[model samples]
Target: MQTEVIIVGGSFAGLSAALMLARARRDVLVIDAGKPRNRFASHSHGVLGMDGIAGSDLLKTARQQLLDYPSVRWLSGEAVEAAVGADGVQVSLADGTLATARKLLLATGISDQLPDIPGLAERWGSTVLHCPYCHGYEVGGGAIGVLGGVEGAAAKAALLADWGTITFFSQGLPITDDEAASLQQRGVQIETTPVVAVQGEQPQWLELVLADGRHSAQRALFAPALQAMATPLVEQLGCRLVDSPLGVLIDVDAQKQTSVPGVYAAGDASVIGNITLASAEGVRAGVGIHHALVAEDSRPRPTAG
Candidate 1:
């Protein structure tokens, strides 16, 4: 089916952009696979007005609101592949359905690759967490642990000191002199023993099992996971990708337009941010797409010779 705009991944960014296009009375189609990066979290934080709301509930309400527009459509399927043609862009779904649109917005979020520690995966969004700003306050100023593996683990530990007593577990990973100095200045303790596993229950309580058979109990563990794109559609569409400290992300401009013309990206796929920033980027992409379409329609045509 043909549409003015096709938004793939109907999470925060996709849905936000679709709302704009729909408001403009553009025929917009949002294809979603029903998986959001924050789906694991029981409640969302740091988002204004909707603070403490469950991620699923917020998305449910947003989806309902977007669908109220007459010009908007939603598809409950994954976009397996995408290609840009002379006229526009085409997206192929997993079920082999084809969708064509003059412009495409990619809000396909990212996936987190957790550390290979046992029991950690099960308590991920509940006790083992990322982004102190998102879940720190709930720690209740208790003992907090930071697992080392990803870049800037020490810095994260130091920053999280304001939330609770921090212990930086190097896990045999080397820490720089500067990092050590900073940790000391921030009153963050350093534990070089490798973490063999995590034993705990939900709602912010954990025990880190050290390789030497020692266990350290803490209110919560902050471990940075390696992030990867949730879908291969970016590569399939030939959009430019850039490397960030966390992972590779799609390259976008001030207006959220991707390297490929008529293609735009937002949310976790294009930038490392939270729900608020993702929604903001979505709004920018939506306005950018709308203006581009208007310009294209208004361009003067050559008279017959």
Candidate 2:
């Protein structure tokens, strides 16, 4: 079947973009496999005007809002492959169906790679979190532990110091004497030994076990929690990637159009942006796609006999 645009991933980003296109009377189809990075997160914070809303509930509301427009179609499945073709772009779904559209927006989000620790996965969004702006307030004024997987964790620990008593466990980072002294001046305790595991009576209260067999009790834990975005669909269509501290990043202009023509990306697939920012990016992409389609239709064609 043919559509004006195909949006891959139906979370905050894809849905927001589709809403704009549908409102403009464009045929849009959104495909999602139901795997969102924030599914474990019960409530999402730090989203302007949307603080403390359940992540899944926000998705449902966005989907409902998008559905109010008849020009939009939501497909609850995966868009496995995407490629540019003579028909503009083609996407194949998991259910063995083919879809063609004049434009494509890739919004597949990323996955957080947690440390190799037992029980941490179960408590990821509950107690073990990455973003301070998102979950810091809940654990404020409590005993906190920051696990440094990537560099620059010390600075993050300092930013979080205002909210709690900060203890940074390097997991094994060799630091200069000056660095240790700086952390000391900043009132941040530094631990360089390896961490055996994190334990606690409940998911909210956690304790870190040292390799030397020592244990430290704590109420909250933070980690860099670096992620690898799922941007294969965009990469498949020849989108140029740029490097960032986050991970493999896509270089796009202000309008959310990728370096490649007729292709756009939003959400975590472009750069590591938050849910609200991703939604905004999607809206920009929708506008760009709409204008591109209008331009195509505006060009004068050969008159038929």
Candidate 3:
């Protein structure tokens, strides 16, 4: 299929970009794998006007609204490969379907790699979390725990203290003296014992089991999750990759255009994970793509010689 713009991954970022292009009467094809990074979260917070809404529900509504435009089309599948050529950009789906467009926007999002602790994965997005800003308020000023091993764990623990009493578990990782002092200054308690397992009821109470046969109860555990690109499409297209504090992300400009010409990236794939930031990046990419397309279409053609 051929379209003006092809958006891979139709989650918040892709959908937001599609809406903008659809309104501009541009033909847009969005390929989605139907698995969003936040699908595990029962509710999405910090988004204006839609605060505390279920992440899935917000996506469903947005998908419906975007599809209402005649120029917009949604494909439920995975884009396994992508390439850019003089003609345009082409994306191949896992089912062998090929989509070509004048420009490509990668909103493929990211995947969170949780620590190898028992019971952690199952309770993720509920009792275990990554972003304090997104899920902190609901902690209700209760006991909070931070599992170590990720970069800047002490700083994270200090910041999380605003929400409640914080317990920073070192998980056997070394903490710098400065970091330890800073954590102490912020009234954050440091626990050196490694967290062997997490136990809890779904979406409510949680208990951390230590390796030394100790258990600590808490309302929620904040563990920094290592992030990785959800798809290899970014590398396939030769887009420049950059390292962020969280993980590797596709390098993009202020307008969300990737290093590769005619290719752009937005959302968690390009920037830090946040619903509002993802949507905003999508809007910027949409406008950037539209302007690029217009400039290309308006170029003067050479006269026959």
Worst 10 residues of 1 by lDDT: 199-208
Off by over 4 Å in 3: none
Clashes of each: 0, 0, 0
lDDT score at residue 205, model 3, on the 0-100 scale: 93
User: What CA RMSD would you report for each candidate?
Assistant: 1.2, 1.8, 1.2
Q: 1-305, model 3: which lDDT tens digit per residue?
A: 99999999888899989998999999999999999999999999999999999999999999999999999988999899999999999999999999999999999999999999999999999889989889999889878999888788888998898999999998888999999999989899999989999998877799999999999999999987888989999879899999888889899888898899999999999888599999988998998899998899899999998
Give the Å shift of residue 224 in candidate 1.
0.7
Backbone clash total for model 1 is 0
**Candidate 3 minimal-lDDT segment of 10 residues:** 146-155
lDDT string for model 2 (1-305, tens) is 78889998898888888988998999998988998878988899988888999999989988888888888888888887889877698999979989999998887877777888776776788778888887889886778888875667777777778778889888787766766777777788888877778777666578888889998887788876666766467657778888766567677898888887788888887767678788888888888888889999999999999
What is the lDDT of every predicted structure here? 0.92, 0.82, 0.92
Model 1 agreement with the true structure over 1-305: per-residue lDDT tens digits: 99989999999999899998999999999999999999889999999998999989999999999999999988999899999989999999999999999999999989999999999999889899998989999778879999997788888999999999999999888999999999999999999989999997777468999999999999999998888989999888888889998888899998899999999999999989999999988998899999999999999988998
